[model samples]
Target chain A: MHTNEKTVAKILFIVAVLCGLSALSLADVVAGNGPSPLIIFDGSKDFSTSSVEFGTVYRGPVHFTHGRHINEHAVSCGKCHHDDSGEPINDLEFGDGVDTCTDCHYEETLLRGKALEGMSQEEVIEHYPNAMHELCISCHKEMNNKTHTLSAPEACRSCHGVKK
Target chain B: MQKKNSKNMKNGVSRREFMRFLGLTTGAAAGSLLLQAPGLAAESSGATLPKFKIHTLNSTAEKIYKCKPGIKRFNEANMAFKQVGKEIGQPFFHPLAANLKKNVANSEIGSGIKVDSPDEARMHLAFSMGAGTWNNMFGPYGEGKENQGLLSWNPLYVPKDLAAHPLHDPNAVDLTKKIKQMSRIYGADMTGVAKLNRKWVYSKTCRNMYDASPARTKPMVFSDVKTPRETDGELVIPESVTNAIVFVVGMPRASLQLSPSSTQTMGGTGMGYGRMGLTAVALAEAIRSLGYNAIPCMNDTGLSVPMAIDAGLGQLGRLGYLVTPWFGPHVRIGKVLTDMPLVADRPIDFGVTEYCETCGICARECPSGAISADRERSYTPPASAGSCSNPGALKWHVDGKKCLRWWMESGNGCSRCMDVCPYTRMTWTDNYDGNPDPDKFWDLNLAPFGYQSVKY
Candidate 1:
């Protein structure tokens, strides 16, 4: 999705305030710099893996194990990541093309019924929340079916903690 | 309109919309101001300071040496002296001899000779503190013979009780200007005067430095002494010593460039301190020769950075080093406490506060992760990080303990922050001139509107 530089800076700033800069790590955190934070994406709270144009508010942290999936599960990079064209993204470097769901699939960009049906596969994924649901649930379903596993947390409460 | 509103309201409100409701936009609006909050908060509060003070005599603005209360001595409160007396770790420059032992054949670079290889030179610079000084650098440190030299100096015990010169003008600011000129000639790149800050003085000697009759050599309780007096091992500054002259000496920039790495080029930092020792000794003697009592100091009395900042040498940078406009963090500090009535210089603003907020080059390159990357400065240091960081100052604090650990890990110390400091190196985006020709590269040389080109 298209995002400007100013928007990017605001996102990083908000995240720094959220992270609670301690006297020791304040320099490393607040500056939004030092040994590439992307190297730690599920990166820093400020500099998100997906979004920059619009900021993020969180209920709880989402634990994504991309490294584990690659090394242990023998997952291919293209299985999850791709360009808007719906083509597999092969040569993903350290901080290659990545975006948040809302960046492209904001409410305005979402599609349904005739609109959803007429669009190409890549175009359909641009529908944001819908795209996130389809991608996650489908992958989980496939994984569960293959492994014959139970308790994969099919509902929102299963993955996201319900605030008391 | 209702239908469109309903369409957008599919899932409560958007995160962006919610943030707007939370009033975080105010935070966004104050971004630039917030970036400056760290440095400015303490600076603006200068006038309200009580026990601590800001001497803005001849400077552009108030000086920034917020201090601990009461008169102190040279050795007792200084961490460097404690490091030496405690013998917990090797002397900071202990590795220099070994570095020189493994030195390569001497080579020629322009007029100077490179007795050590590039790696060895770098290693030496990184490890070149060299047991500090026999006098413990700042003032009296140890007892007996160790307290000989400047440490044993007392204005009362002058070699020849020379009568005060009849022409000695205590009120003349020209005395300070002359001292500044001599300081530059004697190796200081920049110099300023401030009323002696007792709060910044050391509370006592790390070791008893009493070189007196045993009758007068009993150590007083740390709580007992108020104004400085003869108190056994604990050295004290007399009330007569009313003013202080602090100076900044340049480091070899080319040597610092190979920092965080051992290249035998690291000798620059050590060499800078060494030069400071010489400069302080000579300058102090000159001040004393003018019939004013003077005590030279280099890293021994109290914290030099605060004194340097108070003396208007530079502002504190993000990495917690003084960021001089001319030399950046690539300079050593020296001080001379005397009774001479020199006009205190006003503090300076070099835009380092704002610059370091955005520029984290030092923190980013710091191998030890000692430097903070936080955009805003903190008033205190993290607990249990390192002994090197004695927090409580209102500025960006580094994990000096971590930095020292890295120095050990690297078989020497690392100065990666200074290496990457934007002010240290001269580039298209950086400051002017080169590291050599100290007069051209040092902050003292920068913005010397009224001063002439230094003849040296």
Candidate 2:
């Protein structure tokens, strides 16, 4: 009778340990930081996951293809995502939460022409639209020059829409 | 084109040489420079220039206006006062009253009794009536009464909660941009900001013509008040109001083409006035919504032309009207004075001074001979201009009394000067006279809002 009781107790203890291990693994997957969180890198199909939409107050929203830049164009995450001091964030993995472009460069209006006449480089980059424009257009222009073709969109209508 | 170029070259002024003389080498730059220095190429080629003399030193108003040192702000009553047998009657209002019989006769002809078709008369009445809607709703004079109309000086629609906490953005640059964007959305064709020049503000409101009492006219005073307020004696503007947001609304070119014809041309003028009132009121309301004090004005409270010029909207033309780069003299000015901090735009020189000097089409086309044909600008107005002429600045002054008399005789307003100005064409086309056929006007599909976009 004693031996049977001991055998039952031993089996119950083994079952409890297995359940504890499974709960921890489930928590990891739900957190989105685990390798199990599958991020589809298809630009056309999974637009919500593959592209970042920037909503503007006075103009049309811009849709930037994250998947296409990473998978097809071979652009690393460090190219755009930067730290508070403007140092690139290298080794950025899938599902890593990042600050939006406007989070730091947060002026509501575009600053250019005479407005930017006396502003320093740092001050100029503080304007939301101006900074985004400088970043995207400069890169696109450089790419076009390198390839010797107008492949990458550089003009305002290419990103914002044709109406403006 | 080739023959003209060769002819120019024979005069030792090649196309490239002409461009170089204008301080540019490229075609685009030269074309732009031509606006600033017209007739220079002709001068080089020894062609006969216009009789008028140009202010060669500068293209600014300071150069053009030969002002007397102690020039005081003119009284509005002296110019616009309307009394039964007064020598100086209000240009727009008195003419309408004086020409009742002539107007009725003109209306009969316009209604197709004299003329075969009623198309011209119908369109004229429709445009005039439709265009006057906004101006009538909001007073043309910008009375600045509290909660009276859309052009009220006080806040109209700001909620209690929002008013309690005004916009806290410290960045004036961003605010200016937002205001400019809002102005365009509100219906302004062009927008500019300028530091308020107190000299432009009227010293006193025009008195009620029918009133026999002396108290009818109210003094306009700037005081250390929180907001603009009106009293029985005065219209008080706060000294804190430091900036003016000027707006320009373009008049329809098609309607303006029917110049001496009062029916069509008056309709165009009315349309500009109506749009100006609407834009000014809406913009003023918008600024108030953001917890800023604003005073909306249209053809009142201040001189719009000088304020508009200061705001970088345009330069003053010889016809005593604001000529914009986009619309020339075919625009009505509206303004809103506010306490909100903004970056003022710098005044621009697009060559209006030089161009107006040689282009005397406006002066020559005046049916009443109201416009001056003098070669030089003077501090004194022409003797026939009457007391309505404010003569402190040196520029060609129109004979207002004669001009008003013509309106009475014609049974409607006349815009002959506006019609014939070369700037109205906005191109290098010479001998371009717009022949307005009222019969064919209805059949043509005009652009929405009566304005057509001009692409460079």
Per-candidate iRMSD? 23.1, 39.1
Error of 1 at B318 (Å): 1.3
Looking at model 1, what is the TM-score of chain A? 0.47
> Residues B1-456, candidate 1, lDDT per residue (tens digit)?
444434444344555764563354234223212111001111121223212111223432123434233313333322421232222232322222222222322321111224235554433332333322322343312222212355333432222222132123355566876777666655566676766656566543333321111112323222232223444455556567767788876654444444443332234455565556666766765665455666677655556766776666667788777766445676777788777777776565545676566666565555544566566666556543434455445566676544543342233334666765655532111222222322222332211111122222
Tens digit per residue, CA lDDT, model 2, B1-456: 545534434464345643453342122122111111111121221333332211122233333454566766655554522321143222233233323223333543121123333444544545655655555666543432222477677866543333223465547888887787666655676787888978778777765432223324677889999879888888889999999999887666666666553555666776677667777777776677566788988866788887887777667787778876545677788899988898877566556766566555565556545666554555677644556678798776767655644454444456767766655554211122355455454554445456542222
Residue A81, candidate 2: Cα error in Å is 96
Q: Evaluated with lDDT, which candidate comes out highest?
A: 2
* Candidate 2, residue B284: lDDT: 79
What overall lDDT, based on C-alpha atoms, would model 1 receive against the true structure? 0.45
**Candidate 2 off by > 4 Å:** A1-164, B1-66, B81-85, B88-114, B117-123, B141-148, B160-165, B209-215, B427-433, B453-456
lDDT, model 2: 0.56
Which residue window of length 10 is worst by lDDT in model 2 chain B? B31-40
For each candidate, what is the lDDT? 0.45, 0.56
Report how far off residue B223 is in candidate 1 (Å).
14
